[model samples]
Target: MHRFFISPQNIKENTVCIDQEEARHIEKVLRLTTGDIVVCFDGTGREYQVRLEGRENGILTGEIIHTGLRESEPALKLYLAQGIAKGEKMDTIIQKSVEIGVTAIYPVSCERSVVRLAGDKTEKKVHRWQTIAREACKQCRRNLIPEVMPVMNFTSLLEKIGDKPAIMLYENEDTNSLKALLQGEQFTGAKEIFILIGPEGGFSDSEVLAASRQGIVTASLGPRILRTETAGLVAASIILYEYGDLG
Candidate 1:
C-alpha cells in the first residue's frame, strides 16, 4: 500500500484530510481515485489505514479504516552531528542517515569545514535539509522524520548537547572501537546518542581535545579513514545493528 505523512490536526475522528503537495501527488501524479487504499503517518508514531473518500479543491479526503502505533522505530535514539560537507555530499549523508534509522541530525561547522552558511542562507539550507529528511522518511517507511537542526560551530554544538552520551569518530583513535564501547553499556533507555563526524578535512587537534574533555569518547572505525559523508552513516549502521534495530 502507498503511504504518506500528514499532520495530526489533519486527522479528524475517523477521517484524514490530505492536502497540499501530497494531495497533488495523489490526485494528479498517482491518479489514485475514490476507494483506493493508502497508508498515512502523523510522524508521531501513529499510522492509519484509509481509503480515499473524495477530492475537493486540492484536498483528498479519506475514511480511516484502522489506526495503530508504528512498530518500526529503533530502540536507540541515534543523533548524527555531521560536519558540513560540500554540495550533494551533504544531501546524500542526510538521506542515508534517515534510512539507517538516525533519530536526528545536526550540521556542525568544524575548523576544517569547507562549506559555510550565514544569516538567511543558513536558514534556507537548514530548511532544505529538513525537506530531504522528510522525503527520505517517506521513501524508507520511517515512522518519524529525523530532525535537521540548523548549522552550528563545533563549540556551539558541544554546548547545546551538554552531557549527552556522544562519540566522536576519528581515524587516529586506537583504544576504543564502537562495538567494544557498547558491550556492557545499556543504551535501551538513552534518550539521545550523538555520533559526531568530521568534514572532508577532519576535525582539528584542538576540537578533538575539547570533545575528549567533555567526555565524548573518540572511537575508531577500523584503520581505514572514511570520507566525511561515509563516516556518520557507517557509525550509525553499526550503532543500529549492535543495539538490535538493524538486522
Candidate 2:
C-alpha cells in the first residue's frame, strides 16, 4: 500500500481528504484508482488505512478502513539544539535527526556560527527545515513529526532548556567522552534529553564554558573532529541506544 500524509482536519468520521502534491502523485504519478488501499498518517501519532473513493475537485477522498496509533516513536524525548550551519548542512541535520527519533530541533546561532539569518529569511529556512523533518518521518516510517523550532541565539537556547538534562558536544573537551556520560547516574531513567552541537566553526570557548556552568555536561564524540552535521546525529544515535528505544 502507498503511504500519504493527510492533515487531521481533512479526516472526517470515516473519510480522508488528500490534496496538493500528494493527490497529484496518487492520481497522475502512481495512477492509483478507486478501491486502491493506501495508508495515511496524520502528524499527530495516528495512522489510518484508507480505501480509495471518488475524487472531488482535484482532491482525493478515501474511506477509512482501519485506524490505530503508530508505536514507532521512541519513548525518550530528545531535543537537538543545533548551531545553524551554512546552506544544506542545516537541512541534512534536520532530516537525519528526525529519522533517528529526535523529538524536536532548535536552530541556535552561536558566536562561531558561519551563517546567520533574520526576519523573513529565518522564517523561510525554518519552514523548509520543518518540511524536511516531515518527509524524514515518512521515509523512516515514524508516526510523529519532529518540529524544527525557530532560530535563536546561543543564550536564548540555554534559557529555553532551563535546567533540563542536557549535554553540549564540544570538540575541545577531552575529559568526558559521550559514552561515559550516558552510563552515569545523571541519565538514569531520564525521559527528556537535550543535545547541543556547534556549526562549521564549532563552539567558542566561552560558549562551552557557559553551557557547562548551566549544568549542561560537556562531552566529546572522539578524538577526530566531525562536521557539525555529523556530531549531532552521532550523539543522538548514542543517546537513543543507551536511554531511548534505539538498538
Candidate 1, residues 125-242, lDDT tens digits: the string is 9999998988888888887888999889999999977998888998889989877876647444566689999999999999999999998888888979899889999999998888
Return the clash pairs for model 2, or none. none
- Counting clashing residue pairs in each candidate, in order, gives 0, 0
Q: All candidates' lDDT scores?
A: 0.88, 0.90
The best candidate by TM-score is 2
Give the per-residue lDDT of model 2 (tens digit) for 69-170.
979988889999999999788889999999889999999989988897999999999999988998888888887889899999999998999989999998
Model 1, global lDDT: 0.88
All models, RMSD in angstroms: 1.8, 1.0
Q: What residue pairs are clashing in model 1?
A: none
TM-score for each candidate, following the candidate numbering:
0.93, 0.97
TM-score of candidate 2 relative to the true fold: 0.97
Q: Which regions of candidate 1 fall more than 4 Å away from where they truly are? A: 184-191
Name the regions of candidate 2 deviating beyond 4 angstroms.
Answer: none
- For candidate 2, the 10 contiguous residues with the lowest summed lDDT are 52-61
